[model samples]
Target: MDLSGKVAIITGSGRGLGLAYGKELARNGAAVVINDIDRASADGAVAEIVAAGGRAVAVVTPVGTSEAAGELVATAVETFGRLDVLVTNAGILRDKVVWKMTDEDFDAVIDVHLRGTFTCVREAVLRFREQGGGGRIICIGSPAGQRGNFGQTNYSAAKAGIVGMVRTWAMELQRAGITVNAVCPVAATAMTETIPFLAPHIESMKRGEPLPAIIRRDVGMGTPEDAAGVIAFLASDAAADITGQALSIGGDRLALWSHPQLTATDFHDGGWSAEDIAACWGQTFAGSIESVGEEFPEEVMPK
Candidate 1:
């Protein structure tokens, strides 16, 4: 799918998954506006894209604020003449169990991931409407948010909120022909190097060796590039009808995630009292109870 005349803004794209997204989208013919807090990295990314025969520009800035959001969109429009896609890939991680997580930890994650996504999408949507057509909004999400994680209270909350907004905005923007979706990506980057399951393999990655087949196929962990294809496709015309969906992508693994839905429902003649519900809870709801947290197969243990 070619994005020959499209322009895209990918936030936090200096490196890692965001960088992968920018490069992939550009490779597909989209002129990319790269956003990142680090000026050096942002400029380097833009240069790399240009060297590879792709059109790109850098607007180095920390996301999560309305000003930054406006600047990002403005750069896309002023430089490329129009904005066709936005990927809210900026985020931070503060891993701590609930008891140990501080207010600072929580707020920091929320500001970057949750608020950053909100402001960026808001700006992109406004531009799309002004352009008199539709656009693509791809918000980054996490598996931790879909199923709770032990030490990711803040990260999970922010990601969960992002997906929630995607669902809501998809409905609200349907009339305007805009598509909103979430991508839950898993890859080995600086952000995930400390993860216990992937930690042992960092050395291999540093050596430029491919991720072990077992890790990619069984554990679903891979390089950032493995997950970039989906981001690029979502930004292309091919995926215009796909919206309000949460998709998981990684090395050797791609799956469509089911949104929260009722597995079972029962009706009462009137309203069931607390005691009346307690009496029937075991039979009515106990069978459909779902487990939480990410599940790694025993075979996935790092050797």
Candidate 2:
């Protein structure tokens, strides 16, 4: 899709998936603002994009703070004339079991992922309204959030919260011509390389080698470009009617996630006592209740 004359901002865009998104958007003719906490990394991204004959500017600012987020939005407008898209991809991970997770760890992840996304979207929407045009807001989500993973309580909560924000904003801003969506991407990035079992495969992929059969079967190996393509599509005009969606992208796979909804319910005219409720609980709810690990069925997962 042609994004000529469009102005877009991508957070944490100095490296990883964010960098890939910025490059792709810029390559598509968008004037991109690269936001990152590291000045050198941000400058490097801008230099690379410019070297490739794409327009891009670096804005070294952390995303969680209101002032910084506002500045990021302001920079895009000042430098590029107007803003058209805001991609919230800045995030951190502090993995630990619930019991071992400290308040600091929990708060840090939430601050960067959830709060940061909120601030950036809020700021961008204000500009979008003033500009009197529709805009796109793409929030980054994680599989850990959709289905809880081991030792990632903080990360999961923050990512899940992002999906909620996307849904709420999508409804609230529909009339304003603003679309909000979330994407859960599985790719071989700096973050995925941390997984012990996936490290060797990730390294091999980096060296342009094929992944092992077992690793390829269990978790399809994909690069940041795989995820960037999906995000770019969501920002294009073709996706104007598609909002409030939680989409997954990995390898050649694309899937839509179902939102939470009522599965089974027991109704009592007055109110059932503890013993009365217990009597029908097994038949009404027990059969539908899923056991641990059932979420990832053996049929779909690695044998």
Best by lDDT: 1
Error of 1 at 230 (Å): 0.5
Model 2: residue 166 alpha-carbon error in angstroms: 0.9
Tens-digit lDDT track of model 1 for 62-161: 8989999999999999999999999999988889989999999999999999999999999999999999789999999999889988899999899999
Output the worst ten-in-a-row residue range by lDDT, candidate 2. 291-300
Clashing residue pairs in candidate 2, if any? none
Off by over 4 Å in 2: 212-221, 291-303
lDDT of 2: 0.87
- Candidate 1 achieves a global lDDT of 0.92
TM-score of each: 0.97, 0.93
At residue 122, candidate 1 shows an lDDT of 97
After superposition, the stretches of candidate 1 with alpha carbons farther than 4 Å from their true spots are none
How accurate locally, in lDDT, is each candidate? 0.92, 0.87
Best by TM-score: 1
